[model samples]
Target: MNYTYYGMFLWLPSVLSEKGYSLVHSLGYVLVMTLAQVPGYLTAAWLVERWGRKKTLVTAMILAAVAALLFGLANSTAMLIVCGLFLSYFMLAAFAGTYIFTVEQFPTVARATGMGWAAGFGRIGSALAPFITGWLLGVHLGYGWIFGLFFAILLVGFVIVVTLGYETRGKDIH
Candidate 1:
């Protein structure tokens, strides 16, 4: 999720320019997409309380993956904007839920260490994303391929969550 989100957003403007959009338009689109993050995080906060952490993260991952795929396939400007907006929204929401969920899993004594480590490991993905995305583009893989890769990764995350993740919702922390 971090890889996909950071990779796509980091390279989005360049991708748009390569797709023939003017730099100004590309930046404008990116701005609009980035602005969606605020509400996405807010929504995650609400869903974490209402739907629980696991469900919120899983749902956000799935939706973000779909939105990314759709954004890649989009031919019209409107579709691009709409799909981009959704992709940004759900990705950030997933991150928000992840922060809340991960913290809840640790006992107080280890909470800081656990949170720091988890976040640090996640940043590894973020750090690698730009390089990989650049390589993908350099190799001439199309947008569909790029976003399809993200879709696959997100599904893997969903599976990991389903298989290994236990609900932390309403549980008493040690």
Candidate 2:
């Protein structure tokens, strides 16, 4: 989770530069994205309990993919900002739910270990994102392609969660 946001920090400046935006404007994009995290976290907490965790996670992943696609296709700064907010909301929500879901999927004895391994794997991807983004940008590929890639990743996640993840709508964890 931390690495995901951190990856964005590495790419924001370069992405803004590609769009010919000022540092202030670039920072605004980051700020908007960050601010969306608050509601996202809250929404995840509320909805995970109300809806099933699997359903919430799949929904969030789908929404994130949509937002990423929209941001990729955005022609104006305002559109990008709007998409950023949507992306942040879905990303944070899906991340929070994944943490809870993964822990719940394990027995009491192995829950911590399971969560730790899953989180570690997520961090690896996060760590690689900056290098990947930098390389893509170096090739002069547009932001559209970059975001499109993320959208594809999210889509795959959504499919996996829906098809393979167990439903824990009311499972008790001690």
Candidate 3:
């Protein structure tokens, strides 16, 4: 859930306007960032099998944090786009890993129930993020602040995944 808000809210064009990017360029960059997630998802699919769920998730979380931090502190448009691309990559990868791990946490009997609740509750974060971000942006908090908050939230997700996440790799799902 920690990441759900970020995934839903960090529409790069909207957020990058504060990064000193024009709407057109920001939109282009954001489009690239969004497209970049495909590789991350494919990577996660591979890593979840090769490296196992926990490692894949942890790696993605750390990378996501770094990317978000860089995006927040970036001064150049080039840097901003670079960081945003990586941020989306890792964030989506982490989300994919966590989602699979969550589904694997339960037996077949309860897998549907578990997924339902996880998805249901996860939407709360998604629903709330725009509002929170709107308020933050409206207050003239700056792009740094917006991205900084996302960085912090990503850390929270990292902690949660590292501390509480169980390895489901190689375990039978049936």
Candidate 4:
């Protein structure tokens, strides 16, 4: 899941370039993406307290799907940038919430280990995403199709979280 989230950012620049955008445009798009995540981090902190971890994660996944789809459909560079911002926002929210959720799911003795493993596995996904995106791009799949694939992956993540995830609201961490 974390892998998929990080994968989106990994391939974002390549996707932009495939669309005929310059390096400056890609960098600016990245800035927009990063800036959009700030609010999500704060919102995740609050939403986890108010609604609980499960709901927050589920909601973030849904938003990720919407953002991903919009990103794939965006016709212009500006529209793509806007979708990128929205994608970053929800992805960050989901990412942070998962950390909190994972930690809460384990006992103290193994909590750190579990969280570490989860994070590590997510990084593997992140690592693979760039390669996959590059391969697809090399084959001339186009930015729109690449983003469409991302949206599909995010949708799967949402379903996984909703079906297999647990509620961890008001639980003692220790």
Candidate 5:
């Protein structure tokens, strides 16, 4: 979702215009969201160490999903920007945690390979997401459906991480 959102939001100004927002409004939300991401990255780095990887990952994932949903449902500009800020924060935090967790999941033998595969998969999604998102929005299904899809996708990722993940905060990577 992090990567997808990066691509998806590149056209955010237009997307918001579709929802009856001005270009200035769209820029405001995107700008604030960008600023919000910094704290998420910093806090995730701290939480991954203090709270452990799995916990931080799951929490951020959940927050991201909720925020995406809210962003989709928002009727007003203020609500939209607020929700987007939160969505950006948690999504970036999840991204950071995912990176650390993916690295920790592999042993020395295939650490590089595992990291490469994981990032490659993310890139593929990022590459494909714009088309899919454009289609979803093009259908005029509204922000609710488009953002709902994002919410569901993030939830699926959350489930996969939780189901397949193990706690690795203190474990020595060899």
Candidate 6:
């Protein structure tokens, strides 16, 4: 998740520019995509309460994957913006749910440590994304290949959550 999310933030402007948009226009598009995060976070917050953490996260991941695929294939400006908005929304929503869910997975005594380690490991993914994205672009791999790779990663995350995650929606923290 962080892989794709961070990749987008680091490379979206470059991607846009490569598509022939000017620097200012690329930035504007990224800004519009980023603005979608607010509602995304809010929606996740609400869904976590209504649908629980695991479900919300899984839903976000799946939607994000689809958005990534579409964003890669988008040729027109309108499609690009719409796909970018969806990608940003679902990815940020997943982040919100993940933070809440990770904390819930640990008891009070180890919660901070668990969160810290989870975050630290997640940052590893974050750290790798930019370099990987840069390399892929440098190699002249198109958006299709780049985003297709992320699409697979997001699906792997979704599977991990479904198979390994437990519900913590209403249960009391230990």
By lDDT, who's the top model here? 6
TM-scores of the candidates are 0.95, 0.91, 0.90, 0.88, 0.95, 0.96
In model 4, the runs with Cα more than 4 Å from the true position are: 172-174
Model 2 misplaced stretches (Cα beyond 4 Å): 1-9, 172-174
* lDDT, candidate 3, 4-116, per-residue tens: 33543465577777656789887888888888889988899889989998898889988888888788788887887788789888887988788888888888999999899
Q: Could you tell me the lDDT of residue 153 within candidate 1? A: 87
**How far off is model 4, as Cα RMSD?**
1.9
lDDT per residue (tens digit) for residues 18-117 in model 2: 7899888788778878799889978998888899788888898899888887887889988988888988898899887887777888789988898899
lDDT of each: 0.91, 0.80, 0.79, 0.80, 0.85, 0.93
Per-candidate clashes, comma-separated: 0, 0, 0, 0, 0, 0
lDDT of 6 by residue, 1-114 (tens): 888888777899999999999999999999999999999999999999999999999999999999999999899999999999999999999998998988998999999999
Candidate 1 lDDT by residue in tens digits, 76-105: 889999999999999999999998988877
Q: Which model, 2 or 4, shows the larger TM-score?
A: 2
TM-score leaderboard ranking: 6, 1, 5, 2, 3, 4
Prediction RMSDs, each to the true structure: 1.1, 1.9, 1.9, 1.9, 1.3, 1.0
Point out where model 1 deviates above 4 Å: none
Report the poorest 10 consecutive residues by lDDT, candidate 4: 1-10
CA deviation > 4 Å runs, candidate 3:
1-10
lDDT preference between candidates 2 and 5, better one? 5
lDDT of 5 by residue, 66-121 (tens): 99889889988788889988988998899889989988889999999999998898
